[model samples]
Target: MQSAFEKSISPLGLSFRIWGITQLVFSTLVTALLMQVDVLPDITVVYYVPLISAFLGLPAWLILRIALGLLASSRLNVRSRLDRLRWVIVVLGCGYGLAAGLVLVVLWQQSVTGFLTGFALLNAAFFIGCITQHSVIMAYFHVKPHPTAEARPTPAAIHQEQNRTLKKSYMEQTNKVLYKAIITALLILLLLIPSVFIQNLVQERKSRQAEVVHEVSSRWAAGQTLSGFYLYLPYVVSGTTDSGKPYRIEKQLIVLPEEANVQSVMEPEVRPRSIYKVLLYKSRNVFRGQFRIAPQGDFNLSLVKWQDARLCLNISDIKGIEEKVLVKLQDQQYEMQPGTPETGFGNSGLSLPLASVAEVINGPVSFESVLRLKGSEQLHFLPLAGNSIFTISSPWPSPSFDGSYLPGTREVSDSGFQAKWSFSKANLPFNTYLSDTKFDAGKFGFGITMVQPADQYAKTERSVKYAILVIGLTFSLFFIMEQILKKPVHPVQYVLIGLALTIFYTLLLSISEFLFFDWAYLIAATATIVLITWYVRGHFKSFRTAALLGAVITMLYGFIFVLVRLEDTALLIGSIGLFLILGLAMYGSRKVNWYGNEQQQDQPRLASTE
Candidate 1:
């Protein structure tokens, strides 16, 4: 029942392959089990741990296959050297794991219970590997060596003793790799503290800027919304009193325009507050429309109050009204005043009183109003008439069209922008005319918000979100460099490297406040890369490796910047980028042999003293 691959491989190869597979499966299953208890944070890393483990576990699997496969071959002194290597990896691995756990608790502000839980799971997996290695060793050294044969001392017998000593086991080498990986994972978690703090700092600065904007805008003139220009009508109604006595009550009716047209020319300005800035604008608006107040049976018209009737306009901020608002009805001038809108018969938010005009029961009466309004950030208008058309032009390059409807046509460029909107009575939800204060005009308004193209805090906060990816990958990059160049990197050096990586966010945040995000990112990334590259060169002593590390780090920073700019497709693109990076890591590490040092190939000729 042996397959082609199984039949072709030697018994030694089969055993090595089986042992390699066994460790990987056991580690994966144990990881899955521990995750059930909620040991890890329930965030993006919730998915990263398992995928990273599998990707990182592959090289260790290769090391296992090679280390254990040496069992059936290799000489006496080589076996002794192997024993030394095995012990070194185990001692170093366990020492680093416990030390990292301690650091996580003390310095990183993690709870002891959390550290212990993770440490326990790691130790459990390690112990299982130890047991399995013992079995593999036992399977090989099955027979009891002759006691006299050992005393007589043959080269073969000494070799057997060496193999037994090797049985103390280099399979622990897998644990060393996994432990380093776990340690790196811990360092990444340590980085989360700074990353989160940086994010908070970004948010704090953004809030401060917002407060400044609000304060300055309040003084200058806040955002503006214009609704109505509704024709007002008051009439008397007869009603029964509680004792059946007849009473006359006065009520108001509103007449919507039959056709409405608005034209606004906006002049935008910027006001600075300390380190913050806000956008404000002054606009000239012309509202012209026809009011069709035909005969209606809703109330008795014999008691109509023509002398008291007035037109009303809603301007959200009256302070923004820099000049007098005058209406021309049927070519007659009428000045307006402010009114208490909460009662009714005016703009729903802020009411404007117009000069009294007589009721027109014959046909459509044309009216026009000129308003000089001042406001900050935004200017919006409601289409309250049967037929509404809006035409707006501004010199501000970046305008955010927002609210209930978008412009029917828009043209935007650096020079300025022009937008137009047209709507019919059928397009609106409410009737052309309604009782006083009956309609919520704000529910259907559209206009422009002066939008700044570059916002540093928002971009910095988004970059901080990917802090783990940057730290983990940078540490991983250095770890790989260490393995490839035969340079031993201490766990402390990884901490320093991770610190440098996390500091990139702070650098980006502070610098971006003054500079554009792209430029700030460049400066920060370059500074960190140069500093770390120089430090790495000091430890690695090879110009090529350090430069290569710097290049990869630069690419990592660039990739993260791209992800930050993306809103809709960040997850998909980020996932694909991670997969590609992992593939590169695997490919780069394919030929690595942890135990196959120069001494292994040098195999000195020796006579056994045993």
Candidate 2:
């Protein structure tokens, strides 16, 4: 048998001159392939440009030459060197193939075919060159010398030498694996640099949508928030000044209702602006309350002018009030007009003077009004009475109950939604009557927003936030597959996968502008899954391996999509899901042998798709 110290050629020893000739031949083949495709219309691109790109490999060639030279001197033994050599060849082929695929996507419609043909040729050339180089290296495998060893083991010393070899091999394999894992982790972090831009893109798109909504809402009415039907009574008070002179001053007493209830029926409309849709609504509202006309304890009853009392209602957006507002007090009708009455409303509101003192002088009298208003986004009601109850119904299924309080009773489904709120003196933060103070009515109000369910941008943004999880788990999966198949996947391949994941967000954002968010998510996820699945299949040449990866990718995307749509329980569910993912990853890697510890490699063996 030949000694291990015998002279042999490594694939790495394929020399600068021979490699250049092979590269040129490959480039020429690529050019020829491009020439056959009809996509080349211009004479220069047809004849000259593609030929030039072949020679363009000189730069990459020189760089890879320096890298291989450095790797030749590494501490890795013969088997390790051979394994790494095969890995490099695999990467070379896959790198070109993936580049070809990406170019096919990014290329213009006009010249895509010819360009893709050239790239396909490049990929095939690399693949054939890699396989031929592997075969040559394997031909001299028995006689290949360890870079450090000076002599081959004699048959009598083989058993003793085997133990030493195993120890050394174990150390080499451990270091190699540890180093690769570290590089993969770092690559995961590096790939996140691009995901930052993806986040910015998501935000930029969301902001654009916001701008569209604002533009539409500017022409349409803004959100509506309704406050009290205040009973404003102006009285003349007779008081003595510091100089002891008698003076008469007009004093205002504000009285709130004992109980108030509002009923609103909202008809939602979606207004499209460019690529965005703004939610707007026309609401028919009825306000009913009962009031006690009792003045302040300090004030004389004779000074109170009940007839001149103005009943005012504060509407956050008066422009939204569509029609005439009519008030019915004690079964008498009174029309309200915009702007302040007597002691000015101090806000944008409507006011109406009582028909007569007889309307409320007897005792507590019930007051009613019908208001038809147009609004956008949301509607709110302030609890400005001792007891307040609000009932609102809409055909909109996705209503967000926002602000300080939630609806006590609510019904929501695909068909429609109805919500009712009840607030008593204990629940309200304000007093029933305003003696001489200004209260911010909006403070304790509760309302509902006509939220577009599963807002595409919002979901995309949430998905972007989980980029690390997607990329990290995917890289881990690929790494695990490498151990299982005993074939090393390159860092660049992992980067491409990360890039594909990031691109999925952009796809979702763009598509969801026209279609529903769920459909857009499904489409984007499918496209990305198909693409990555195809690329993975090209690498391993096994349908089962590619399908395994595709299934995992699908599950990851599906899980993220679910997390995005679940607003209320996202945090809890995400935490649980991540824990489970960690468990599954651990389970997947449980039996994976990091090093060929138990099994013996009689020779330096390298696996090949061929």
Candidate 3:
């Protein structure tokens, strides 16, 4: 009689290997197609955020195929009845696989739901086909009759048979352990594919949000900056030529403020454009400074034309000025005009005629101004003084202090925020004279930006980044439960569960816009947990098992939430969490004799048949 190993190359084994290869090839093509789905919509900038996790499906399907091939080889060696029911299930899975592949071809990128359904179906076919093949193999072995004992064998034949049986047993045991591990890994990787798409969706939404912000900012005033209080001193030089003819030349002398103080109070408001909101503000600003020209030996003071002097202040946007501005020079008041008398400054500003204060040129001159302006988003200032002290207060809760200089002191609360910036001449690169027309005032500028604390799209993107870990742990939990209960879960059911998890991100993103991120996350996570738990309860018919699954999922979501909130230390926290989870997994599966369990599960059925 032939040994089991010699009989292993049966037609059924060949067919099973062929099916495995076919499934692997088909899944590889499908995975490649799914990767192309990341092609973004037509926009000025396209971000090819690769859905690399989707590629994991290929290896997962391949692993399942390998498991099925081994199972089939083991079964082919055993003499058994052909189970028609198991054959029917395998045929059905094959049909599903073909139908899913057709669907992918028909609706490549036309519909996201179609693509997801097709992807899930292909995965399900591979998974279900493998499990069904194993079931058929087990049934064949269990129902097979042992050889009659009437014909006694020779001693040498018996010894050879015993050795063959031991080898077969060892191979079967190894295959069983490998089968369970491969299935668990496949399910985890299959779940990860949808998460990649979900992350891509989050990125798309964020890009749209940015477009909306740009549109709104274009209509309203963009960020504004104020750099000013330069003293415009016009002077005339009179001299006698070689022929004793007198000549006069006109010149403008730009003087920086010796000491400056600025105070601003802003009332901010939110304007909603469609679903997006923008920040706008009206500010009441006060400026006070002194400008003095130290007596120099370079020019004769007798020929100075101090009467042509003017006081000027530069502003970024004239449209943002809501009310009239007035400048006070000592005891005299002058109404501000639209343009600066000195055109060489290359700035748009308001000027006050200071030709009347010619007597003040001999000493330090004090000036004051009151400005009422309306702007949007951000407000900035330049340090154009030898000594400058600037203070800004707003009713907006969130403020981003940005620019070349940060606020020396700041306070933030639910009510509002206050900030102060003080700078001296030593802090600036230029001296009292700013002759470079191309000098960027923004370099020395500091500003407060009114912004939202938590953006929904951003948080959603962050959560999606943790998809692999979440899916792996969740799938492992299910696999462990299956091993303990000796109850198998269908591949289709795993796909459904994964789909539900992917939808959680979509629900969270949609709900966050209307509610706070924390509340949205709570609602989305609760809904998903309840759904999956209820489904598992129906499948297992055990409340305790379902509750345990739900608890694990809840913990994962909570852990992810903490990681997202702790942005600065997310990497450290994530590493620690992963290590702890690995320890738990290791401890949980420490005593699980995967092969022993298979033997215990199969032996009783075979014995009963005998």
Candidate 4:
């Protein structure tokens, strides 16, 4: 038996060196890809930053190296040296494990499940490396040594020794070839890391799309928010000074209507600007409301100059008004002026001066108005009355109801949509009376957003988010094929395959601009699958392997499409999908002799000597 110091030197030193070099190259590539996401054009989506996955590769490489070292030292039969080396491996492995755990904690702060998935993959790599290294070492130890001079007297014994040496040489050659294939496969996986930059490219393109939308919206009319027809009453409060002198102060009182109602019909049109399209609409609206003044018993009306009261309607964008607004107060019609009575009412609106206040002070006052407005994207309303009711109908198929309140009743179809909203002071934060303060009426009401059902850029961004998984799985599939077939695949071929995968996104993004998202995905995925299948068939010279790969690609693309469309259930579906994929991989590789079958085949030759 060899002493511990004698057997300490690993027979697979060259293999470990190759693995280390490959790991270094992979680390560099992963780091470069991670940096690319930071430089991508600014877009906000809660996505797993590919950088987290990239950093995990570093610890994985370290753990693998330590595991290989441990396996190498395990060949020593002597107790003392083996014990010391084992402790060294334990320390190094623990340190690396702690570092990896810290990284996972940081990732957990950003996203819980992302961290869990990453940690699981990292541990899987480490354990797989441990198993592979241990098996190779065990196989090396099992090889029988040449016969000693004391046993080599007979001619038969000499021939048997020769045969044993030949078998050992063959096993060594086989091990070298297997190790080289593994290193090559790992290198191919490393090369696929750069494909993550394609996601950044997708984001940049999406940013440009947003810029175009903004340009178009700014040229037409931005989204409009119509606040109200509030009563603006200017008054004077008299007070006695400390010096016994009389003083009067000017003030304005803003009173909301007791009840208000609005009816609007919007005609929507799609305007194309370059390759992007924006939603715009022309709205014809009718506003009717009633304002009632409390009697003397309810409150003091002595200071109110009711005659000086003016009816003001708040419009967000005066430029969007398509027709002249006319107001009818108490059966008397008055055309509204361009500016508001006081700065108390917003700047961009029209106001009508009342002729008398005696009737208004005595009882309830009624008013009506007609307005024709043109706006882009969205139409928002403010709940400025004690009880407000708004009804809207449009020929737009997609409407996103956005704001503090949702529509009480809504009906939508392929042809059109109709929505109604009801709000009261009880539900609102503020009371009916307001004065001298700037109020954000937008926060209190519902808005109708005329939206495009499929935003190609957004969908493309979503698709790009899954690039890492797609590339990783595809590479794993090819690696498994290489192992099973025992065929050598060049690193360059792997790069070409990864590039083909990366180009899928760019194709999807460009095609979706002209076609629907679903159709674009189909066309892009099919073209990519066919191209890869043909390329793989040519490389492997096997139709079965190529067909299987094509089917896998098809299934992956289909799975991702389903994930994107079903956003709410994506996590559940993705988790289950991943579990099934892992199960399939485990099952397929169950019979693989990771240690090489040459050791088992040569076992009988050694037994014959005994």
Candidate 5:
């Protein structure tokens, strides 16, 4: 056999570079493959954006490696120098690739617990990649020099030395794997115990919060002040003005209800709180200069404002109408507006609130009226009412909309206008509707009105889902960045970030119970962003990087604000953001080269001073 003095190349040098190139190519291919997968018909295309983001780093990273490789070849000739930089880049690229794969797998096909399990598997892959790179670097440096006494080693001896290096690398890799297995097991056990407890606590808190909200809503509706008004006009100035003298409108509205019950009527709150009240007036049809009350045509009656519901009239037909006409308290006056010749209520004459109205937080109510014009001329009130204007019960008496109130199959009843709605704790509005429902008095126009709670729980659930999706997408984008840039991100950092985002919902729910949702969101988002930004600075070594991430986090939180506020258009906005991010990444990576180290080698240039 030849002596051990002969020179030889390290097998590690060949294998390590090959392995690095393979990993880069493999990662890039996987990312492209994942992005190209067709989304199932039933699944929303937006849901795939996170998975796409997780994979986006692979191609960019590979191109970076290629650039590093070209730089190294042109400048560095020594294996030791090139290998050191190569190991760092290789390990970083592999670690990022494995991490992104794990994130995609977790998001696409697993529960929260299962996703964490996937993360542990990902960590194992990372450790394996790290050991592979480390071993090659260590083996290259570990060779013992031959003794000078042995003269010079032959080529055969050099071959034997290369075999030794290979064996040592194998041993080192095996030890690394064994250590990783032991640590992984221990970590799994430790995390599992706490994870179970934490998850249970979260579930319990959600249950308790939902229950409290229901109870609060029930009490609020029950405690609302109940009050309304009733009117009775016994005496009236039923008259017609002179021909040119702007119809001398004179009348005395004797508050009949006031005289009937002086004690109750004079009560501070009960005495017609509204400044406007209903009034009754009648005019007779008569010939010119003749004083004969004739019920020939329609009569004019209207409401006027004094301190209470009163009357105002404009008599246009005094030619065949008498100067004086009799008036009667024919119906309950919710609100009455008498029509004139100038503005005649088409066909039918005056509208009178004839039915007794009762206010209830129960089912909605429907009210009907007849604009009677003398001998029974009737116009059927169409299904023209909406919202709180009328409570049209479906299935005759049941308080529901869809259970019995189908669109085409409506049944007209004595109840005038038809309006349908559902009412319960589950039906209360959560976000924008809260302001509309809570603040609007729900009394307007010329229809009967009702109030009922909407689907509050459904509203809350939708908001929460979108919030979760936004945070999930944000995390995915960050994960992709970490992979492409080979940024160091610890598990603890991920946990803290997730916790910061998760707390946003809790904050929103708690603050919104008493304060307005807008204000609540502002306080919660600002606090969470500050906490996360501070924590991110700890994760990243540089303050500039931390501030950059802080800005991203701030923008993400603001993005969620738009999602929550613009419920109808949130999905569209989120899609546009995804497209923009993809475009940005593509543009940034256009000139990058693969098959190289992460850090470029500094080229030595001749200087005049030297």
Candidate 6:
């Protein structure tokens, strides 16, 4: 006589292992396919796959029940017979119930009012009907075996009848148990597959997220570069040259690094040094000799918009010509007449001295002049010659300047002193100048501080809230539904509830795109609550219960909205909300009896004397 375990094990003989391996392989292949498929190409098909598959589980469950029935019949005689009849009833009832439930769901999806109400009502009705049918069938089977009859029989007859009945009854019960077990296992496994897949998918998504961050950082580092320019202008009219008629003199320079040994620098150095000769001519109309920066070539420049910039030159070797120089800026031209301060070139950007001195070849009088220009304005800088060397300038409709030019300052300092002077925007037409102009100025002299973008904080806040709201709402709805509905609600039901929750986020994003977040949340949350409340009321028997659930949902929405709005406290708010949900669920489920139907009433007992 072989043992039961040995017999069972012998029959499975590597088949179970093979099946497990095949399942893993198939699941992996499907995962890969799902990842590779472009959802945009066939979104409808992809979206419906899980939905269709959920309903498919019902049929799989039925088939497994049928197979279990056959298997039980060959072994347990009495239990098998009882089970077969039980399944006949259960299978038929469940089949009708499932069919009706699915139809109602479809109707609800297509039409919210009439069909949806009927649909939800139908599911509730079917659930009750199926349970009633099961109870009736079970009672009938138990009572049917023993019928009212009067019979006086011999010992042999009695014994034989008892044996037969006992065997039949035993087999019937065993078969029912086996069939139920198999059906349950099948349903559970079907649900389990998706859960497992989702877990793996979540892990993969996190990994991809990390990779994306790394990729972005790498790109930013690769694109980093450096470019800008400097200039200086200077001149002298020392009592005119001998053959001079009030002779005027001027010198301009495209300043470069004073050091000639340039090769001692790193290769691919974004910052380079260059110099240009001063192209100068002399005239009473100072503009005649001044070289136009032309807002071109490896340089950035800006001037007041809508106003002409008057280039004035008053080169005087003031205090420190050897070290630095001094230049006084006075308005030589006017825009709307110099009636008030605003009528003049006004204040804008920076104004400093452009000081230079004659540097005779191999002469000690040789001096390099540094011209500092500054202003605050919006402008654009683009690579000139379509290369790395950029030029900054303003477009049309910009400000213009007059009497704005400060004549070149000349100074002589033996020890060389750092020229310190005042530059004010008090001379510009408007208080607000283009940052573009300032940026160019920074490129030329002032170094720009690399910092976070202005909108980064707000954008990050929006994205975090958006993602959390969708994910939290989705999980919350399904979790609540599962809590309220004791019986096994299919994953399809969970998915639908989740979809409704996710739609809230979509609505929020759309409305917030046009309106404020507060208004958007109000509209979206109200709509979601109304629709879900109406559906849930129909799904359950009591409107009050549905309203209560709706209230909880609304509260959750408010909580999420708070999370979205309060940037500083979002984490704390979310954490507390999560805790509250968990505590409520824990407290609610404390009294639940897991072994039997919750709807079943408790048995009453009569008091007994001690």
Clashes of each: 0, 0, 0, 0, 39, 59
Query: Candidate 2, residues 250-339: lDDT per residue as tens digits?
Result: 777777788999999999998877777889999999899998756556664578776666778988778888888989888878789787
Cα lDDT tens digits, model 6, 123-223, are 33323333444433332223123465887887777667666765454544444335444333323222222322333344444355445534433432221
For model 2 the local lDDT of residue 137 reads 46
lDDT of 3 by residue, 1-610 (tens): 4345535644456345435644554455455545546432443222221233225334544543454445445645442122333333345444554456466557455444444445454655455444546644554344345687687787777767776666567556656555566555656655655675777777777788778877776666566788768876656777899999999876555678889999999998788877777778889899999877674433433545655556778777777888788888776777888887544443687876666666665667888888988788789888888998999999889999998888999999999999999988888887665534455666677788888887888888888777767776777788777767767787677778878888898899888878899999999999999999999999999999899889989999999999988878999999999899889888987766565534544432221111
The candidate with the higher TM-score, 2 or 4, is: 4
CA-only RMSD, every prediction: 12.4, 13.3, 9.3, 7.9, 21.4, 20.7
TM-score preference between candidates 1 and 2, better one: 1
Every candidate's lDDT? 0.70, 0.73, 0.70, 0.69, 0.38, 0.36
What value does the lDDT take at residue 112 in candidate 6?
Answer: 24
Stronger candidate by lDDT (1 vs 2): 2
C-alpha lDDT of residue 285 in model 1: 93
Each model's TM-score? 0.72, 0.66, 0.71, 0.74, 0.34, 0.35
Ranking by lDDT: 2, 1, 3, 4, 5, 6
Q: Which has the greatest lDDT?
A: 2
Segments of candidate 6 deviating more than 4 angstroms: 1-492, 597-610
True-structure RMSD for candidate 2? 13.3
lDDT of 3: 0.70
Residue 66 CA displacement from its true place in model 6, Å: 18
What is the Cα-based lDDT of residue 109 in candidate 5? 58
For candidate 6, what's the RMSD?
20.7
Off by over 4 Å in 4: 1-195, 241-247, 295-302, 305-309, 341-347, 355-362, 598-607
| Distance from true location, Cα of 42 in model 4, Å | 16
Better of 2 and 5 by TM-score: 2
Candidate 2 residue pairs in backbone clash = none
Predicted candidate 4 versus true structure: per-residue lDDT over 531-609, tens digit per residue? 9999999989999999998998899999999988887889999999999998998898776544455444534244254
